[model samples]
Target chain A: MKIKPECATCIIRQIVDISIEVTDDEIEQFRLVKGCMPVINEEYHNNAVPAWMGTVIHRHFKKISNCEDPYKRLKETANDTAQNYIEDVENKIKNSDNELDRLKKCVLATIAGNSIDFGPFSISEDIVPMIEHTLNSELKIDCSKELLEDLKSAKKVLYICDNAGEIVFDILLIKMIKKYVNDINDIVVAVKGKPILNDATMEDAENLKINEFAKVITTGSDIIGIILEECSEEFLKEFEQADLIIAKGMGNFESLTEYNLNHKKLYYILKAKCDPVAEFIGVDLKDSVLLSNKQLQKNLANIDKN
Target chain B: MKIKPECATCIIRQIVDISIEVTDDEIEQFRLVKGCMPVINEEYHNNAVPAWMGTVIHRHFKKISNCEDPYKRLKETANDTAQNYIEDVENKIKNSDNELDRLKKCVLATIAGNSIDFGPFSISEDIVPMIEHTLNSELKIDCSKELLEDLKSAKKVLYICDNAGEIVFDILLIKMIKKYVNDINDIVVAVKGKPILNDATMEDAENLKINEFAKVITTGSDIIGIILEECSEEFLKEFEQADLIIAKGMGNFESLTEYNLNHKKLYYILKAKCDPVAEFIGVDLKDSVLLSNKQLQKNLANIDKN
Candidate 1:
């Protein structure tokens, strides 16, 4: 979860890209990339988390450009794009033979939606094809059966959403979980408190009516994933209390894995897009993963005892 | 070639790669990338040339790693790899029906050899398949016949060498120029004075017996391409005096094109491997370019007149 040496280049590449997007003035673009180099120089280290560094650099970029949300339009477009695929995903999940099949299909659809990423790595911007690809592709790290078993005892399920367009598909999964996992007393969806890339915000979740399926909350800060310290006390209580947490996207995997949160149920659902994440997850780049952070959680359990 | 914003990432990526390669020590890798950030921060700009910044940062890397010629093993491997392909290339040229076919084959084979690159961009290190690929590919901008016509009246030629392995193929092109273009009085093969990447040094040129084909000299500077100011007075004099300049590889294309050199006959013969260089040549990426700097040369002529 710590930033790789390669992350230095990728993060800078993103800075350059966003800087260009934030302005037409070449001098301004130059100034933005120029100014952010010090931030990267200061923060890019072995122990720093990539997404944590991303937040630092992106905040610096926004301060310089006077852009409140660089990816605002993209998030809107992504929401619209994913809107078209919802019915298709619903139909595919409905076609499942049994509850497990239906649930797995929903998970796959959500993982497919994770492809609508604007991270340092390139993925297919075209949505439905990726939907089709993900549905057909087997998860590289499947723990859906374990997820199903955990649902049996779970009182609260917290779903952390990633990108906006993809959040539409996530809505499908939430609906499926609610309909079938009837024992679950609560379903909570957490979105970003502020805009970062295409990551869904409260406004986006509200526009999508994510509250129709579950209680919606923000991470309470605009850092990537759940940096526990940055989260609101209310959100942290929910994070601590949740029996099963469904975390979407690479950013969460990157940010959350840094802590030894023992006995916490964290499910990382994403497509392995970059070398660092893929290598850490022991999967090929671009492979779909529905991974239980059970291993980390259990390992930390023993570490805590020792 | 003014540095693209993307170049910031790429150059840093190169730094990270070299830092890792230079030392197995993780802390050292961190330190090396860490130490070089200031240099990148200080020099990376819209106006800076990528290769020139490469020189600056690489010098900084060399200083930190306390390593000389980080790519020395790869260079040796490249030379050995290319040595195996020379006979095959020579045979292909020999099978040509006429002078134009033979000469063009030589150029194509030479361009194919340029694929043995270890820059930030990924290229197939496999030599012969690229040789086959290049031979099959047409010059996106063909001026081989023009090169032949120019050769008829040329007094001296300066053949700038690129990577170590590719210099093996350059030897063949130099031989063809010598044999067919008999009116040429001199042929000078210029290589790097010190090692940078796999760029041919005098040691590599000498090892490959390039002296058998033409007189060999160093650029008098280890910097990428022809930084005319940094280059030795002797090499700069040769650069100015040579009637036809056949520059090999992207580095030469990057560094040499910054000058006005209004009347100079500079043929940039290489594969257009990156976006900036490809755009400048008006060719697609990975296209073979036997590009005459005629447009650049003539455009500057108008400016000079003004």
Candidate 2:
């Protein structure tokens, strides 16, 4: 998605959130914020997506403030909070009568995990209410039925995880997919090779014991989302091999939606947290979205024809 | 009144609103928006208020876009719309039994005019509903009684106007003050020397026929709000001599609040439109405030003591 005027504001807001977390020095915080404006003006053009812009701006923030992984403590806290709800969520999925119902519940659970993000604003101390709220609410863009059909036929399913605490929830969905849709051997979970925001890394996947359920690998880059050009050749081979890809969070949706990789099917499961993403997905801000590549292509085709 | 992190976001949003109005070229709009970030970063620091920062950033926007007075058409529309309702508003005040009651109603009418601003967002097609809503609503910070008391004793009153459409409402209040509290000869109306945002200029004041009601003058600068240092020698003289100064809009509130001008009384009458301004005034966003310098000093003194 091209950077809209609102995106510039959002990028600065995110920087402020991180700046506050990194330091209590008012002067230093002020300087850090002041420094970001030039980078935003220069780097945030040429139809840059938020994730790509976030990557560049955040790196600059870290360099100036000398605070690597500013979201470190928050990530741990989010993981712990999300860990508490894992059992309850698993039971909710288990309680559903049929396999299709279970699969749909898992998709909702995964999308609920996307809400545990700390990059945009301060991390919520309690995600229990958000988890419950999302579970009860209907997905604004639900392509779960289509996703289930694709999952059944796909040989390999690549699950891209978003935030740290949310990775615990992703485990539940992965387990459900293995039990109902695909073999465990065919499922692989991809995490960031390094930290960018609170996006899960191999370290988080290891901490969550993701390897116990399915194979885990890194995208081989610390970039916020899957910037295909920046990814390692090994990760690309895996990406190209996968029959179905489940992208989690707004970052992935932004980076992936820019190009048409017609060789593979992509299903995005995330909460539309910002205006541009919400407008793009035809949903309200904060609405959970389960969108399919097929549906997106059809929408694009319609727009082109008009 | 000091700049907060939220103010940066708001400034960018305002730029976006103006950029969209200036051009249809996405690339040009993109370039214009990108250019604004550095100005915002550089100007909006070290406890700078929005008005001060806005003055600097908006000047750059105009320089780049080559569109001076971008809000010209919207300002005309706001004036026409507000003019249509002047009769109904005057009637509402006339229905009041006493002078004090009529004065209070006029104060409300003037605040209702402040809502016609088009700088931050698109101009509302109709302001009748907003005026009606504001009329029926209670002021979140009403110092009208105190203002009335000050006006009764004061020999000279300097009334600063905010926007074009709202100036008509200011006329009603100015007329009321002339009839009940002070002579029309003692009253002076101050507007911008040149166009800045949708803020009222000498042209607008003349268009509204403000001379028929009282003496009218310009502040001798095109800056938003009453920057005391930037005022012309004549305006400074009037500003100094006035027994009581009635500053209109959030711009005045911001610029005036920075100094402790103890010699003369100042009453700010405006709607709190943004988060930082609302927080500064201790009112909710969109709430109307009629704050007196006397009350503000008292509040400040109490805070100091605490």
Error of 1 at A276 (Å): 1.5
Query: Which model scores highest in lDDT?
Result: 2
DockQ score of each predicted structure, in the order shown: 0.72, 0.48
Question: Taking the tens digit of each residue's C-alpha lDDT, what string does model 1 give over B1-306?
Answer: 787766777788788887777778777788889899999989988899877888888877877788879888778888888888878878888899988887788899899889888774543234557667897788888888889888777888989988888888888789877864444448888999988866889999878777876888999978977788899988988888899999998888888888876578889898987777776666787899887888555544676687
User: What does the interface RMSD come to for each candidate?
Assistant: 1.2, 1.7
Error of 2 at A128 (Å): 8.2
User: Per-residue CA lDDT of candidate 2, range A119-236, in tens?
Assistant: 6544434556778899878888888889888877888888988888889888888986776445565788999987788899888999888888788888998888889998877678
Stretches off by above 4 angstroms in model 2 are: A73-98, A116-140, A181-185, A202-208, A232-234, A279-287, B76-105, B116-142, B181-183, B278-287
Two-chain DockQ for model 1: 0.72
User: DockQ (C-alpha) of model 2?
Assistant: 0.48
Candidate 1 error regions (>4 Å): A123-131, A180-185, A297-306, B123-131, B180-185, B298-306
